[model samples]
Target: MSGTSAGAPEPEGALEPEGAPAPESAPGPRRRRVPRRERERQILDVAVQVFAKRGYHGASVDEIAESAGISKPMVYLYLDSKEGLFLACLRREADRLVGAFQGAATASGASPELRLHAGLLAFFAFVSEHRDSWVVLHRQASELSEAIAAAVAEARRAVMAEVADLVRAGIAEGGPATQLTDEDADFVTHALVGAADSLTDWMARHPDQSPEGVTLRLMNMVWVGMGRVLEGEAWKPVTG
Candidate 1:
């Protein structure tokens, strides 16, 4: 009648007329393609959260992938395994911390003391800014697999070595009065690292304290004792 008869079938395999544009198919869901570096960073960020919350043994690839809005296969493809992912997080955080320390330690033409002050400030600032990273690097990594522990330990040792070097320079520049035997420097370096690590927890709790304040307090505590030792003062217990 007026229009095509009801239920009339169109011709099979109708084709577009020559010189006419074909009808476009409906669009499918768009696949968001993240760059490899950016995707890896996203995965690592989620992984750190999972690891921090669950610990190494409790953290799962599925959870990490789901949290990252990626597939488990994608996580494995990017990081190989859970341990690999944890190690990646450790390396990244450790590198960041060591780099911060090094940059602050050497960023100025200031004296060794000032450089050390800068380094401590950088360290506390890093801890304040990246508490998750600190937990991952400081706590979780140590309790994970042996391979992970070794990797974290190596990073720690590297930072410690750098600190020891700074101490050595300070001693050398302090003239004969501040000179330290290699053994003594090594001892002091270990002690200093230990003290900083312990204080980092305190700093986390005491958010009101400025990094500069913490650094200055630590410097006062360390340098005062160190100055005495540098002048060859030794403490001995009184015998009964």
Candidate 2:
């Protein structure tokens, strides 16, 4: 008997006729080309995570490219350079955070207290959702080059300005009883922003707390003192 295996024969309906063109193989799935804006967003998203995780000095374009599933040259083509990429990430996240605050603060024709509360809630919600972005903006950017530091400072100032506007508006709306001077309002804005930044870090460490909960705590601490100050009562140090 021949040594050929019976299983090797072509199955019924599986064979093509001789001299006929070979059956065309099924075309592989087409690679969808992402839109320019979307691709840039994807690159920035990966860049933010890489920068946040590794810090600017530790992070590399090659690593970001690999993680983003694109080539180094492509990243450069899109973002110009490593510094440029980091700047883009910083600007994007900063805008997003600021936008959230503005949107919430201007949501309704309600009281300043309500607007401030909404802004705080939005701020905490953004921090909770974009922890990497917060890390990149808060921790990593400051340690980077001077240009990046300046850019970050500008973003911070923008956020502080927005909060300051809210504080000023609150004083105005509170009428003559709220005796906060422009200087006092500025100082209060700084305190509120600084406290919120610190508490954001604290919230990261204690993830069990909700954003609303954190917002409420901050509102309670800030508004009570603010109310007292607005009503012409200021805290004084005890004289020895």
lDDT of 2: 0.80
lDDT value, residue 73 of candidate 1: 70
Q: In model 1, which range of ten residues has the least summed lDDT?
A: 1-10
lDDT by residue (51-160, candidate 2, tens digit) is: 98988889999998888776776777666677888888887888899899889989944787888889889999999999999998898888778988997899889889
Local error of candidate 1 at 188, Å?
A: 0.8
lDDT of 1 by residue, 16-56 (tens): 22332222234686554555566667878888888888888
Candidate 2 Cα outliers beyond 4 Å, as residue runs: 1-32
lDDT of 1: 0.77
Model 1: per-residue Cα lDDT at residue 119: 87
User: Model 1 compared with the native: what TM-score?
Assistant: 0.83
lDDT of 1 at 25: 30
